[model samples]
Target: MPKSAVVLLNRPSLEAPPHVEGAAEFELLDVDAPHVRVLDLGVTRGDGVFETISFGAGHPQALAAHLARLAKSARALDLPEPDADAWERAVLAAASAIDPAPEAYVKTVMTRGLEGDGRPTGWAYASAAPDHSRARSEGIRVVLLDRGYRHDVAKTSPWLLAGSKTLSYAVNRAVLREAARRDADDVVFVSSDGYLLEGSTSNLLLRFGDTLVTPGLDQGILAGTTQGDLFAFARSQGLETEYARLETRKLAEADAAWLVSSVRHAAPIRRVDGVDRAVDTDFTAAVNSHLIGRTS
Candidate 1:
């Protein structure tokens, strides 16, 4: 089975099939078939947390960072803490099952389990990543959509799970769909107060003159692993970096901006709100090299 296939894993019977005993073609399952009860909050109420780690060179890049975020997300949901050792084993097994040639998206999802049982339903697996070569090379068109929340919402509403990367992604997907209706490839979400937040699935980054700026974490944005890594790399390269609140109008004055994430990496935003922005391929190349390092 290809890694991309959804293999059911039953937590009760944690047994690997014979074909999965050794190296298999894209291992998608490590245990028996799994079936979630219809009443499970994870599905019915979208009560869960997840992390997507970039799998390459036989292991996940930024494994520690991803796991840390997963733990934080789980805590935010009041779900059971993640078993790092077990997750480590599952992730390694899944990554090893993939064909060695292709880069993969390895995800770990933990839900609040059944409505009453209280046991968390967690699994880690690898899958083929959707190709973003065109967007990476040619750049992407984006539109700004109001996130419909104030920047201070996180501080005032704990139940909202503001900074948590929860599984409740319906709104995010809907926003992206709306962006598509506007003939845009992606979306940059801004707060109701006109402060830049983040993308539907990525962290927003801007290059303002010689300085790099990203929205401050206090604004209720999911902490982006990719953005954190890139910022460290940028500083090492002697670029000035700042984490401050930004207005959507900053997009117009930016030398360049991108929606950076673990899977898509760094993709330039050529057009914002149907208006063309700057594109610096050389800068993108340099940053990508720093982001992924020279893998030989």
Candidate 2:
């Protein structure tokens, strides 16, 4: 289960796996090929959605919680509900296919099938993404944007382009490009309401003094999987925590901040525009101990 630093998606070398109908039942067509299965949640009228989870190597909780959150996220999206039993079966099947001695990142993506003639073609798919562990420590740089992606989806966005990870990732890509233009590594969006939403691909966090703060989900932010665990770990260790509408000024003043997600884990925020600061603190050690069961 050795994961690649960067997965060659366009260059899928692993063989396609047989149909993955349930969670525990998956089969790779070949060792050198990557099998990406498809499941359709028949929604043609722009109501499509999916979730991604991170089950870190050897640590079962990450994956377990990810699955639990996946079910909840599916419910939140209000699309067709996924069969839990089938999901469980799929997980087992996928894991069985892997060599357990080495574990890689496991991701499950569910999407809404094509909708046409003013409706959707009923279909949904999920895939176990190949593990890419390199992004965790090297860190990701992000650009801050004045505009945010709080759109109404199914919800025609660029017709034939749904933003539910269903299809249209153009905007997401564009945002990244914009970030690149600004000399930043990634992007973090600020709402007109003045609350910090999130990065283009993940959640935002700030460690203020001894307290950790983030924007609440009420602000149209995606509930981050790693963020939840980080906060939980922080609380367990006697650190104060809070979730509320965040302002750009507060983030600029934060002692330390990070953009978190499954793939990147936590990328420290080095500097915010108009606010020059140094990112010399290492919360990674503390966070790693709390997250991965490593003791100092």
Which candidate should be chosen as best, given TM-score against the real structure?
1
- Give Cα distance to truth, residue 25, candidate 1, Å: 22
Looking at model 2, report the run of 10 residues with the lowest lDDT sum. 5-14
Residue 146's lDDT in candidate 1:
88
| Residue-level lDDT tens digits of model 2 in 1-296 | 42222111211101222232242233333434533333333222324444444334434335555656655654555434555454554444444445552333444444443332222221112233444343344445665686533333223333433222333345667888888787777788887545577888778888888899998765556667688889988888898989877777777778878888765566777656534554534676467445544211
Question: Candidate 2: global Cα-lDDT?
Answer: 0.54
RMSD of 2: 7.5
Off by over 4 Å in 1: 5-34, 294-296
Best prediction by lDDT: 1
Q: Give the Å error, residue 21, model 1.
A: 21
Clashes by residue pair, model 1: 8-34, 9-34, 10-33
Error of 2 at 70 (Å): 2.9
